[model samples]
Target: MLGDSAYKLALETKRTQAHLPMYNEALVHHLCRETRHIMGELETLLQSLETIRDEPDADTRSVAAQLAVKHATVKRNKRCLLAYQAQRLRFLQNVFWQVGGVPEEIKPQLSPAELDFFSGYALAVNTYKAPFIDLDLTVSDLPPKDLYIEVRVLQDCGEVQLENGSLLLSKNSQHHVKRTDVDHLVSRGLLQHIDG
Candidate 1:
């Protein structure tokens, strides 16, 4: 699903075209495909390790060294995959921000890598300040007022305080809340926005 979304977005981006300097669409596709490939490899490695672990002690001794090597490979690849995803997220964030603005629900859910990339992006754009024209308009703008949103909670969110009252978001529960209050939750992936 993620791979399909990434590819679709890339194709749409290339077809529509960008009027300003932005992240490369084709590169996004490549990174997404690479991440998916690494994830598949990691899954296979983990399953193999599980199989080895389930064997009897006597049988496992012979391949203990091999299992250790495979474990290390899996760890390394997992880190690589995370980094690639972070990079991809950063690019997408910028792309969406530039065109209109990153939806409020996505801003706070940025991973460490994506946050770091955002920091660098912020600094780079800040340096381009204009003396008269004020060319520093890179930051994303805010959404409109009065939005009605429906979200399905992916995990327990404890109690969230709102202006009107507090609500507990239980796992797998669906609720209607204002976008302002739940945007952060959605960005954290704790809640999935369900469009009517």
Candidate 2:
């Protein structure tokens, strides 16, 4: 039993280490896809607005104005996504550093925003005399979740073996679980919280 437990720990550690790279890549890809989709929708709206703006009808003019607002909103959303992507990449970089550097091929190219984030992170850690640089600046101030909720899995998560039984998270699978139990998966876009 002891040997079995030891082997499980070792295997779980290995999976955790390997999962980071996959998670990081998945995050970047998701962000990029969302940004591109928003940009495409914005472009289409702009193109349609151009025609409406040239029309003499007042209704068309109002439509154009609405499209303009939508365009601006999409631009703002894209910027927010970009900012989030940078922050998330920086956080992953710190995590990689904490456990030793990631594999060269899997390492993402650092952006100026990421570099700036790291600079600020280092400064804050130094100023506070932090023992190790493993702080997750994102969502650090959020309140704890006390409610359990239902979530739908968007991807296969393999078999999560727990103390009593194992949970199978195949694609499109739904499960009722605590927020803390699926927080990481939701953050990684693998699971989605279903509002009741």
The residue pairs in collision within model 2 are none
Over 94-162, each residue of candidate 2 has an lDDT whose tens digit, in order, gives 553443333354445455455466567656655565664544433224776555778898989998753
State each model's C-alpha RMSD to the native. Answer: 19.2, 19.7
lDDT score at residue 29, model 2, on the 0-100 scale: 51
Locate the minimum summed-lDDT window of 10 residues in model 2: 1-10
- TM-score for every candidate vs. truth? 0.33, 0.33
Best candidate per lDDT, number? 1
- Candidates' lDDT values, in order? 0.59, 0.57
Q: Provide the lDDT at 33 for model 1.
A: 65
